[model samples]
Target chain A: MLKVHNLSVNYRGTEALNSVSLAIHAGELVGLIGPNGAGKSTLLKALLGLVAMHAGQVLFEERPLVHQRQRVAYVPQRSQIDWDYPVTAWNVVMMARTVRTGWLRSPNPRSRQAVEAAMQRLGVWDLRDRQIGELSGGQQQRVFLARAIAQDADLFFFDEPFNAIDKTTEAVILDLLAELKAHDKTVLVCSHEWGQALNRYDRLLLLNQRLVADGDPQQVMTLDNIQRAYGENLQPSERPAEMPFFC
Target chain B: MLDWLLEPLGYQFMRNALAVGLLVGVLCPIVGSYLIVQRMALLGDVIAHAVLPGLAIANFLRFNILLGSFVSGIFSTVLIAWIRTQTRVKVDAAMALTFSSFFSLGVLLLRVLGSRLDLMAILFGDILSVSRADVGRSLWVTLLLLLLVKLFYKELLFYTFDPAAAEAAGLPVHTIYYGMMAAITMTIIVGMQTVGVVLVIALLVGPATTAYLLVKQLHRMMLLGALLGVISSLGGMYISYYLDVPSGPAIALTSFAFFMLALLFSPRQGILTRRRPLRKP
Candidate 1:
């Protein structure tokens, strides 16, 4: 289980989140949704210790998340990666084995096999030798996903995994998440996906600078909750006179 | 052709210069390959120039020049990191502001202290006057760099390609980052004697960038870049010997020339002849 208690983050002297708390258990695929600048990504970063929090801490299985980082795999936003880096998909996947392989040594046979399996499972086995820059947006996302899969961690954190990706990559990622959930691994994904894509997650965290709602997809995706989350951006004046519902 | 090549090898000074050139030839490209791939080529230039103040002070005090240069180089690295993180300045902007200002301060201090250091040789290079001790130090530094890369190849590749992921994967990322900075500083400090301060970045960035266009993997890039470095350094030394040119500029020009040739004719990425391999001689 993962517990984030009294989580608050301040960005440039402004509180991005105020006293938000949440808990998630294993075998759960949770989606984090919020408007732009509402701290969906910030919360993930804070939990991973990639960003400093003005208050709060993250615990996994009753221990600090930092100590158990070996079992945690993070895939940053797609925009953060350098596609022109002189590396292939195979090399990207091989990076996940570095920590397990240890210092001053190459990846053992087991680790290599894991990399091969992850790429094969992701349908990127044939493209292993291709440079990342030469890959499509969908393929690039899959490559990073393949790297995460190769980590074989108990926990997975993905930020904006569906942004700008093709439908195929989206389906592949969803299937992988389902597979991970079946194996009792905890998965937290931050995305703006609504409607059908939102149904795949066991739980949805609707956030807008704070925890607006956290519950089942049917309950959390209500009109009231949707309005509360994106209410500021929902301008009633912009809608047609016949359509009364702004959400 | 063999006699012409052997002619320069008879003199001990020429031999020592060639040794220094060879060492630097192998050193710069490997280090530079990392810089180029990470889009941190300017960082290399920054450190190379940042070593100036320490070198000037070392000349003033009459101690080992590399020691002073090293101290100043480390200081600049720390300062750059600090300024970049402490302010809104981006990495490139911070480096630009740091290297230029540090270089100016070094020139000022040199003038204030009235050191007899030849700015020309230090700025360009006088590889002909390289001593045996300098050659030995360059050799050791090259060996040390090679070992560091060999030991941390996997970690470094991950970190350079995607640092956040590397950090998330529980690697000691800060240590790796600082260790790389230290290595770059040491490489520049030792490389001062062969290519001097101004043109040192040429060795650090040019060959690796050329190899980068041709190779698909990091180690292969380093390996091929090293080969190009050695050939260019050796060729530049010969050009200097026969044409009565300055060694540093000659070497830098040779490296740039090689890059131009590769850019136009490389099998994988050449603008003119890409998509087809050249016929073997």
Candidate 2:
């Protein structure tokens, strides 16, 4: 579980997040949707204690975010990483155990086994030995997810997980998230594809610098809310189609 | 070939020069690999040039040149890191400001201390003139540095590849970052005693970058970089000795030539200057 109150963020004198408050409970898959520069990514980073918060306190399971660091794992935006780094998929996933392993000791057999299982779960076991730079975008995303799984954290923050991924990879990631949810793990995922996220996520927090709405997907994904978040750029036909549920 | 290399062992100067060259060649690339991966090639240049003023001031006060260079390099590193973190001043601009201003101050100091100092040894090192004490000190320092790197190889590799991930992993990314800067300063100071300040950047970046173009794995790149560095250093020494060319420039040019050759012929990312066949319209 996580709690954020009056979380404000500024970038070079420009306010990105303005007094936003929210809570995410355990075992919930919450989708954060907004337009470009909508403070969605900034809010996630602030929650992870990666950014310098202007004014706010983030508590994970009633503990400060920094103190409860090991309980939370983050998968940053794929574009933020330098893809050309000389690291194998295994090495990357193993990094998740670094906090627990400490500086002096290498990953133990147990940790390594956990990494192996995480990689297998993400379907990157065959690619574990490959250099990270050589992996495709989807593979790289899966590698990060494997890292998150290896962390064995109760809470996860994923930024733009579906961006630039193929439909198949997207489905695989969604299935992984579903598995995480089943295990009582909390997930906060930032995404732009509202329609797909609306179907998958348990709760939706629609935002554009300010908190526009927060509730069930059907209630949050409305025409007026979309218009307020995106302004006049919203098209009538662009709203989520009323497709029949198959599952 | 053994006789040629072992024969120089009889002469003290030859022995010192060879030992110093080997140590610098091996040590520079060990640190240089991280520098290249971090895209801080210019940082090496900045540090090399920035140390000049400290050297000049030390010379004016009749202090140890190595000590002076080390102090200045650390100062430059801290200054650059501070500027980047505290202000919106970009990395390149900070590098340019620190190196240029410090280097000019050095030039001015040299002018003021005209004819009172023997700076030729500092400007263009005479490896043949290396004292036994100098050789001993450099060897010990290099050995310690290489040992430290070997011990902390995992941490360094993790930080270089993904700093944010390393931080999230609670690896003290900032401390590692500054630790690397300290290592680079030490390496540059040692290298300056052989290659001089002007050519130090070549030893820092040339071999490692060339190795980068050839290898995918970090360990392989480090190995190949050391190999290239040693080969180039020895080859440059022999060529310079036989041709009576300026040794410093000759050594640097040799590494540069090797870099260009690798650029053209490296298997993975080499530039094929030769024309490709035309596609059908």
Best by lDDT: 1
Off by over 4 Å in 2: A232-235, A238-247, B1-10, B113-121, B272-281
Model 2 lDDT per residue over A1-247, tens place: 7888989998767899998999988889999998898999888877776778899898877888877778778898898788887678888888888778876677799999999999998899999999898899999999999999999999888998998987777888989999999999989999878454577889999888889999978778777777788896766663335432111
- Per-residue lDDT over B1-281 for candidate 2, one digit per residue giving the tens place of the 0 to 100 score: 88765665787776787788888888888788888888899899888878887788787788997788789888998999899877899999999999898788877888887636446656665677677887788888889888878878778877787776666656777788888888998898888777777788888898988888888778778889899888777776666566766556767888899899988987767787544579999
TM-score of each: 0.94, 0.92
- Identify the CAPRI category of the predicted complex in candidate 1: medium
For residues A1-247, could you state the per-residue lDDT of candidate 1 as single tens digits? Answer: 9999989988766799888899999999999998898899888888888778888879999999988887998999988888888899999999988998999888899999999999999989999999899999999999888989998899999999999989899889889998999999999999987556687889999888889999978778766677788885654445444332323
DockQ of 1: 0.75
Give the range of the ten consecutive residues with the poorest summed lDDT in model 1 chain B: B268-277
Fnat of each prediction?
0.82, 0.29
i-RMS, each model, one decimal: 1.1, 1.9
